[model samples]
Structures are given as C-alpha cells and as structure tokens.
Target: MRPAPSDLEPVSRTAPADGTARAGRSLPRVAAALVLVLLLLVIARLPWAGDLGMHAATVQRLRHSLLDPGNPLVDADTPSPYYSPWTLVLGVLARLTGLSVFVVLRIGALVGLGLLVTGVLRYVRTLSSHRAAPALALLCLLLLWGPLLFAWSGFLGLNSLALTVSYPSVFALGLGFHFWAWLTRAVRGTAAWGTWVALGVLWALILLCHQFTGVVASLGAAAAVLAARPARAVLPRLGAALASGLLVLWLWPYYDFFALFSAGADLEAIHRPLYEHLAARFGLVLLGVVALACRARRDRRDPLVLFFVLGVLVFAAGGLTGHYSWGRALPAALIPAQLAAALETVSAGRRAVRAGWACVLGAALAVGAWTQAGTLGYVVPRDRLPAAVAAKYRTPWAGYQWITRAGVRYGDVVMARTFPARQIPAYGPYTVAPGYPDVFLPDADRRAAAVTRYFGGSAAQRRGIVREYGVRWVVGPESLAGPGLRKVTAGPGGQVLYRVVP
Candidate 1:
C-alpha cells in the first residue's frame, strides 16, 4: 500500500508556484504580524483586571525580598505558587532597572509574545514544511475559538491573549510549544544523554512557570512520545529525562510543588467557570476535530489525536470528580485540533478539498475575529468603535492607586470589601483578607471573617476586628464613617479611604 501524502511535504510544493499565489500566501503573514504589533501596544497599556494585581504584587514582593517574598496577597510569611522561575526573573529585572512592576510586566509580555510566535512557527514547521503553515497556524491559534469571548490566562483566543499576554501562563505556553517541537525531533533521531537531561530541566522549568500550562505541555509531550513508539534503547534516555524533571520539581525552594495537589478542593469553585459555555467557547475548533479524524483514519498513532484524547480524558475526569482545576488542561486538546485544522487546509492532496477547507476556515476565522473585536478597544478608543464592537468591550477594573497615593505603605493592612481587596495589593498594601484564595495562609478563614465583621458587624465588634488584625486603613463608602475612622480621600466608584485614628 502507498504511504499517505506526507504532511511534512517539502517547501517547494508547499510554497506558491506563481507570483499571485505567493502574494496570497504573504497576505496572512502580514496580517499575523499586524495582530502581534497590536498585542504589543495593548501590553503597553496593561489594562488592569483579573489577576494583574496579584501578579504585580508578586513582582513587588520579589523585587524587595527575592529569597523571601512571602505571601503575595496578605501580610504573611508564607510560600506562594506565584513565585515561579519566570516571576523571579521579572522580579530581578524590576530590582535591577528600578522599573515599576507594571513596566517589568510589559517587558515580560514582549518576551512571552516573542517566544510564543517563534515557538509556534518552529513547532508547526515540524508538521509541515509549507511556508504559509506557520502564518496560518498562528492565525488559527490566536483566532480559532467559539464566538463567545472568553478570557483566561492559559486560553490563547485573541481576547484572552490580549488580557493575559503579560502573565506567566503565556510564558509557560511558549516554552510548551518549544518543548513539543524538541521532543518530536529527539524521539525521531539519536540524542545525547546531556540533551535528554536538558530537555528534562526545560520541562521542569515550564511546569514551575505556570502549572496549568505545564499540564498541557505534559500531555502534548506524552502524545509526541507515544506516537513515536520509541525503540527499547530510547527508554533509558526518557527515564533519565523524567528523573531530572522530577528532581527539579522536588528541589524548588520557593514552594512545595507537591503541596499544590492537595489544594485542588480550594480551587475547584473558581475553575468551575472553565467548563461553562463549552460550545460557545470552543465551537470553532470542530473544524480541527474533522482534521484530526482524517489523520487518525490514516494513522492510529497520530500525535494530535492522542493529545486531544488525553486532554479530553483529564478534563472529563475533572468535570465528573469536581476537580475543575483540571479544566485548565482544555488547551491541551484545543491546540492540537486547531493546528491540525490549519495544516490539513493547506496540505490536503486535492485542490478542491483544500479550497473547501480553506473557505470554511477563512469564514470561521472571520467570525472569530469579530467575536474578539472588543480587544481593539484596548488600542483604540471604545467610543470611536462601531456600536457592535463597543458593546462587546468590557471595561477593565480601576486600580487602587489612590489609596497608595494617600500614604498606604507596604505591609499596611487595609480593611476593604472583596472588590477593592483584589486591587489594593498591587500598590503594596495588603488587605485584611486575600482577594483570591490562599492555600498556604493558615489564617485565611479568620481573616475573611474579620473583614466581614469589620464591614457589617457592630461598631464595638469592628474595633475588636481592627485591633486583632492591626488594620490601619478602611476602604468603603462614605456611610462607613465612625469615631475611629477619619476620611483621607475618595476613589473611583465611590470608594472612600479612611485612616484609623488612635
């Protein structure tokens, strides 16, 4: 029987045979570049929203105390998962350059975006030598998701990437793509022991950088390895690599990497949202599903199909077992499907089929782009946008910089509502309770109760709560005034700042 048409066809056949075709191929590349530049500009703005404050606070702590940054959210000396290898490097940059934490994050965003773009190109090249494959794959990876706009750290939809470009998730994901590419090449050829060990170290680094993306990376790597069906001789090298990676995870000093496994219960509530609106969130990738089915028909060991299957199993188990944190692994399935769709469109043996796939993909991409058009509000004035686009834009949260400007110093404990609590730490002050969950902070529940009492309890109880936590400031509405509280200033959204008077 004849072998199936090689997905890894030579560049000559993949590239356009004529000037017009070459121009057509070049168009997508140019569009991809423009999209990247727009993302960079969005990074420059660094709109404040979910987890940005937490990350900014993490950098601030690391900048001040690299080895002992403590808990990023509350005023406590505890290890935090946010103190990963990538954040540590950013912390050092903040300390060395005397740049603000947000500026450091912008720099980090540029680096992450560079890694992601180049990594995608390299990994896609391993699948298809087509000159346009990388460009098309980039476009698909960024835009090929369901019509509903979902923004999360690990998800790579255009709107999501715009919001989370500066996050460690992006950095980890970039490394993940490179990991898949390297693993693919290593399994196919002879590799030195040192090379395998280095790969192990890289894997550990990716895990430490962003644990969720690390899960996705692990699944992809496993797919690549299993699809290769390595010889007996390669098993020893694979073992060495695994051992090295485990060693790194064990030796990590900032936090107990294994401790995170037990913290899943605390995280499941927040992650449940990941499973909602599945069809609206990922419907566009069905095209890729078709592509994977085609590939699987020809070769049962197809890596993308294996990766998707592994991701689905983990995700389904999460939904069934109330381990919603595992939902973060959805990207592991989505990415391969998205890439497969892009590759099959360009590499189909017949012109008619390729054109049909391309037309479908092109239409899907256009719809996806419109769904995420609200991201343009980050670069352009929302009012200037068309009504449809403007309506899609969700305003970012205002920062708590006013309280900081009013003299709330580092380590100052502020009693605030949940919303303000989320943003205050970015400016160096800690809230009475953490804005997000804290697995390591032993007094999280008590702290939360204290915050609640301060807000709604009797005056005497409020005093007791303040004395217990050493609260120096109170942030709330003007109606919150009392004898011990003196108004300092007002903030956005009618938030009043009050200093505790002895």
Candidate 2:
C-alpha cells in the first residue's frame, strides 16, 4: 500500500482511452517550463517591479561593493537586513551578465521560482496518498499556493525573500537535508572530489543570502537526515552539519540563535491574528487525517502523519509569541500542510479517484500560472507608488547628481527624507541633519519636521535654516502651497529650491 514515486503508475482515468496513443511525453515538460518562465518575466518586468525597488537598493549596494571594495554603493542602512548577503550574489551575477536591472531581477525570479516548483513536483510523486511532495505537492497547493505566491511575489519585492524562506521548509519537511548530505558524504567517489567542498561553499552562501531562513533550512535538513540514519551514524552526521553551521556562525555573530539553529524554520514570518494560525494548523491536521485514512490500516508505518501532527502542536503553541516576537516560526506550518496535500494522492481508488485529485491540483496550478501571467499584473502594484507625484521630486539619487552637475557645494547638516529629499541624489563627504533612513534612523515625525523646516518652511523659516543646518541653499520637492517653498518645478510631486537669505 506504500505509495512512492518508484512505483508511480499512470492514472487510470485518461488511460489511452479508445486506443488513442498517449500524447508525446517529451513535449509537455518543455512546454510547461517555457510558459511559466516567460510569464514570470513579464510579471517581474512591469514598471512597479513591486517591492523589488527595496531589494534593488540592497543589491545595488552589494554590487557597488564588488567594484569599489572601499565604498560599496548600496543605500546605507535598512530595517531588516539580517541575511541579504546570501541573495546578493544573484544580483552581482546578473550585473556581470550585462542585463538591465529589470532583466536581472526577472532572472532571479524565474530561477528561484523554477527551482521551487521543481522541488514541489518531485515531492508530489512520493505518493503518500497521491496528494503531496516534489511535483508541486498535492494539486490544491499547486493551484492555490502557486497563484498566491506568484501573484504576491510579482507584486512584493520582500515576498521574493519570503519565498526564499518558504522553499527550504519544503526540503526540510520533504526530502530531508541530512539524508542528502549523508548521501553526498557516503558517495566517497563523489565526495572525495571537490563536490563536497563545493556543496559546503554553496550551503554557506545560501546561509549568507537569507541568514535566518538559511540557518533554519540547514537545521531542518540536518535533522531530517539524522533521523533517517542509524543511531550511531546520527551523532556523526549531526556533528558535521553543526560544524558547518558553526563555521559560518563564527563569521556572522547572529547565527548563534538556538531556536533558529534548533527549530528555526518554525518562525519564518510575522503573520498576526493568532487565531488564523490555529485554523491553519487545524486544516493541516484534518487533511492529514483524511490522507492517512486512504491508506491500509496497517500502513501506520508512515511517519509523515506524526511529522505533521507534532509540527501542528508545536507551531500553534509557538504562534502565541510569533506575532509580537520576530516571526521566525511560520515555516513550520507550511511543511506539514504541503505534505498532507501532496501525499493525499497515493490513496486513489480507481480512475475517478485519481482524476479527482489531479483536477484539484491542476486547478491550483492553473490559477497560479494565470495570476502571474494575467493582465491584472500589468497595472499598478498592490502598493501604489504615489507616482505622477513621485515623478516631480527629483529622486534622492537624481538630486545629488544635480548638485555635482552645477558644481554647487551642499553644506553639512542637510535634512533627508525619501519624499523631502527626493532631489538629493548621491551626497558625498557631507553629513546631513535629518538624514536618509539608512543613516539617521529617525521616526516619521522627526523626518517630517526636518522637511518642514528645510523645504517646506515659511519664507522666514527658510531664512532661519541658515542658523539651523548651516547651509544657505535648500533644494527639494515641497508642496507648492506648503509653508516655505518657492516652486522650482511643478506637477503632482513638485520641486522647491530655496536659499536661506539671512
């Protein structure tokens, strides 16, 4: 009654009906990959590029670092940059490949997403109940999860990193990382060569990319592998993986978190409404129950159920704090739910049963594809960029460029806020008063005051800034009717340039 990929049989529903030969096997695979890739690129290339701007900023800095070494050109300071190094390589690699920023982002989106789907599909074939694992895990996940992730990832740059976290949870709960590592080591013929070293480096790089998630993934993988090995072998395997983690930890101090190192994947996000978390766990349990019921009563040998059950209990208990705390625990829920869905397929009774599950899974996949490829993706992103207005103020990047072109010397202690300092491009060798989020880390109120005093001040206040910031020239986008602005440029997002005439 064991349903495994090694024993996969074609579904009986559409089996060579009426003696018509099955469609060309080779074609569908290629077609599926191409359609998905092209569609993903389109969604990623749109003007908004979603939250990609934030990541682009991050990658921009990392890219500049490679060339300047002394001064990486990334926007300084961000809120949550705990694990940016791991993914930055892709950005660096994209620049080297000579693609535009848009194309490079699209490339990472395609590659990362493509690999994610691959992992799902492969697991689906494991046939727990014919529901979940690599092939994209059960069809419902394929349907709903794909569309949700595709649509969200296309619309949110931060979501890309979120997916980076979610993908490894699949591996942690599905294939078992420790098993893969052990296999890598066991194959001395393979391991003796540089393959081991390369894997080590690759693993380390991934850890660097999204340190928190990467560490969680590594721990989950190592644990899964350890569980599968002999009692004696478990200790050795555990030691090796831990050592690898330790080596990286030595380089980056934050890797020392025990929960992250222990049950790290469990807390991957900060989703709220604690009740929702409970509901999700309950749903997975329900699905797990139904999937296990399809198997022979004696087949309780499947530890997949227990894996999911324990995960549910632990995560629900942990969710109480995940909202208030740094949500590093959400990944735990994703694994069990995926397994329950994908593994459900193996219990198919006849043609109808298999067809039923496939239809469900197929619908999920279709919606995912449609969401990424749909016309809805072409318009403004979920978060409106306040454009036409955004266009008026010279971006901070552009403003700095303006000063260089004019050969003007901006004084020390200029104020900085994304909107207020939109005109301030790259400023060098000068400290600003109210500064970029990277440097000053001020709250919105302080930022607002600085903007009010510098760009939006009354004519008298503008005159007073000479005493405030020690600079005579003030140039930025301030609302025309606002207190102290003389219009430099106007549209929706207007520009104001003033010189304090004290």
Candidate 3:
C-alpha cells in the first residue's frame, strides 16, 4: 500500500517552480494571514460566556481565596480532574489586567485560537507545498465555526474558541495540535533535542489544562505513526515523543486517567438517532470523509489522510457513545486535513471542475461565517445576566437582588429549591444545601433528592432536610415561608429569606 518515495517527495519539499515564492513572498503572506485570523477571532468573541456560571464560580472561589488550599471547586471540593491550571492562569491574568474574568477569558481564548492557527499551518506545510494551503485551511475552519457542533465543541479551534471560559478543553486542543506539529518533526529526525524537551513540557501543560485533550493528542500521534510506516526510520523519534508524553503521567501521579472512562459509561444507556445526536453536522463530516478518501487514493502515504481518518474516529466515538466530548477533538485535526484535501483536488482537476469546487468551498465558508455570527449573537448579546442563568435559581428578582445586596458570604448554606442548584454558588459566595453536584460522589443523588423533597413536601420533610443538611437559611417565594422560620427579608415579588430555627 506504500507509494514510491518519489510520490511523497512533493509533500515534504516545496516544488522547484515555487522556491522563489516560498523564499521571497511566503513570510509576508503568512504574516498577513495570521493577522486576519487574530482579528476574526477577536470579532467573533465580542460576545462571551456560553456556559459561564459553573466555571465563573470556580474561578471566583479560587481568585478570591474563598477556596481552601486543598480544594479548588467551590461546593464540591474533592480531588478530581477538573481543576485546571489554565483556570489559575486566567485568574492571574484577570488580576494583572484589572479586567473582569470574562474579559480576560476572551483575550486568553483569542491567544489560544492564534496558536491553533499557527499549529495548523505548520502541520499543513509538512504535508503539502501549496503556498495558499494553510490560508485556505484556516478559512475553512473559520467558516465552519458557527455550526452547532463546532460552536458547542469550541468553534473547531477557530476564533469562537471554547464553549465557555471555564472549560479549557478547547484551548487545550489548540496546544495539543501545536505540540503534534513539533512531535512530527521530532519523530522524523528533523527537530533538535531542545525541541523534544519543549514538546514534553507542552504535553505536560496540556494534561494540566485538560486530561481528555492529552488523550486526544496521544491518539493523533498514533495516527501519525501509522502514516509514517517503516518503523525503523521513525521509531527512535516516536519513542522520544511517547516518552515525553508518559513523563507527564509520572510527574502527576494524582491523574486518574481511567476515572472519566468509568464516568462516561453513564452515557451509554441514553440513545438518540445518529443525525440528531450529532447536531446535524453529519453532512459536512461526510464531505470531509469523502475528500480524505480521495486524498488517500492519490497518495496512500499522505499523512493528511491518516489525520483525517483519526478525526472521523473521534467524531464517531462521540456519536456512538452519546458523549459529545468524545468527538470534541475533531476540529483541531479535521480542519487542516480537509482543507489540504480540497486544495489538492482543485489543483488536480480540469478548469471547469476546479472552479466549481472552489466556488462550493467558498460558499460553505460564507455560510459558516454567517452561522458563527448568529451563534455568538446568542452568547452574550445583552449586558444583563442570561435568562438561563437567571432561571437557574427561581428566586424572585427582588429576593435575589436583596441577597446580593446583603453580601452572601462564602460557605453560608442556603436551603432552597435545588432545581439548577449551581446558581447560588455561581453568582455569589454563599454555599447551598445539597452542595454536591459531583457525578462521582456516592451521596450526590440522594442529597439532591432530599433537597427536592424539602422544597415541595410537608413541614416534617422540611425539618428533616434542615437537620440533615445543616440548613442555615431558607429562601423562596413567601407562600412557602411556614412556621419556625424567621423572615429576615421580603421582596416585591413575594420572595422571602427566612432563617431556619434551631
């Protein structure tokens, strides 16, 4: 199945006819392209916070020293994989910039997007000599940005990066791809010892940012090995890359790599039709798959083809398992690989066919841009808190404003309807009863159930919830403010805050 070395040479080297273009004009074009990418990312991110509440709560706790040194997540303090070092970086940036964490996150996301573009370009340069290949690839990625699957998955490593600032997986994906470009060079004996060390540090950083992204990177590297073939030439370098990745696990012994697999098993019982489950991104995905097949047929040794194959596997894994995150890694690899294939197809085609394909790709990109704009329109369109966040805690508007004015302190337990229980902790320092939102916690479900009963059940059940959960205060609409509770505050909407009697 291996193509002759001559067929592979064009992929690895610039065509002689374009050597002058590569030498004289490439730098200017590349610089211009990067600037364009950065600007687009900035514009796309003007509206922020897709799911800002949970992550904001975590950052708030850490930044304000509300968290115990040992605990990172606010209500659920137990050690888990979600405590991200990148979150700390964002917190520190907020401190230094004197900006809202939201603003800092937007800037940080833009930087991550830029790095991702650079990584894609480097990776594409390794597999194709076409000067416009990198630009075309990035444009395609941006055009795909606003589609539901890509946006929810963090804009497929484009300008609309990260579903929210709190989740660093999207940013980590960018770093992971950048790391892959370096690893490929190392594996091919083209990178220096320093480059290998840098890549190792990069791997460690990705693990700290999000463990799942690290897993995705490892899979991509495996795909690269398959594309390289003839193990002897690349084995030593591949070993170096593998060793670098493994070194991180050794250093971070607390990392429970198997933990998420078990946790994700919970999703297996829930099923949806493949198209609906994939958010209707299947058509674009099919096009990518077909393009990759064509690229492979042209040259089986084309590394781009293998990379796209791995992307499809990741996308399919998510669909099959009902785990959206499993396929979240698709954008980083798929965007560049698909673009390269498209460019190659256009270059190899007859005049009429080439123009038709170009127009099709161009139109797809335009549609994606419009989709991105509309999607972001829904993200942070207004200055006020989102209705989703507002509805999380159905406190009357006046009652919640009163709590905010009263300065709800850290660790203050408030008993209320536990529907969307993350609200109080997310918006204020006060802890809520049934604090455990952890999937891994053995008592989480029971606690949630008990809290639910307290809100709607008889007075006897309310007392049991208070006694069991150490209820300090009860907050709700006035009608539920029964006996043995001292109403400390009242609101125009008939909401009340009552202190639970001893």
Number of clashes recorded per candidate? 0, 62, 0
TM-score to native of every candidate shown: 0.96, 0.58, 0.73
Query: Considering lDDT, which of the candidate structures 1 and 3 is the better prediction for this target?
Result: 1
Residues 232-346, candidate 1: write the lDDT tens digits: 8999999999999999999999999999999888999999999999999899999999999998998889899999999999999999998999999999889999999999988
- Candidate 1 stretches greater than 4 Å from native: 1-17
Candidate 2 lDDT score relative to the true structure: 0.40
Q: State the C-alpha lDDT per candidate.
A: 0.91, 0.40, 0.57
Cα misplacement distance, residue 119 of candidate 1 (Å)? 0.8
Candidate 2 per-residue C-alpha lDDT over 1-502 given as tens digits, one digit per residue, 9 for 90 to 100: 7888545555543466523222322233454455444445444543332233444433444444443321111222323332234335544775577655445555565555555455445434433322223433423332333323232221111223233222222222223333333433443222332344444544554555444345334544443343344345335544564566456645653233332444333233322433354442233334435654454254443434444444445555656545322233334334444455545543456757755755564554454444433333233343343543233222212224444344334223334444434223223212233222222132434445655665555667655644554554455555433444233333233544443332
Candidate 2 residue spans exceeding 4 A from truth: 1-35, 43-50, 67-83, 87-91, 94-100, 121-142, 145-204, 215-223, 226-229, 252-289, 292-314, 322-328, 346-352, 359-376, 379-502
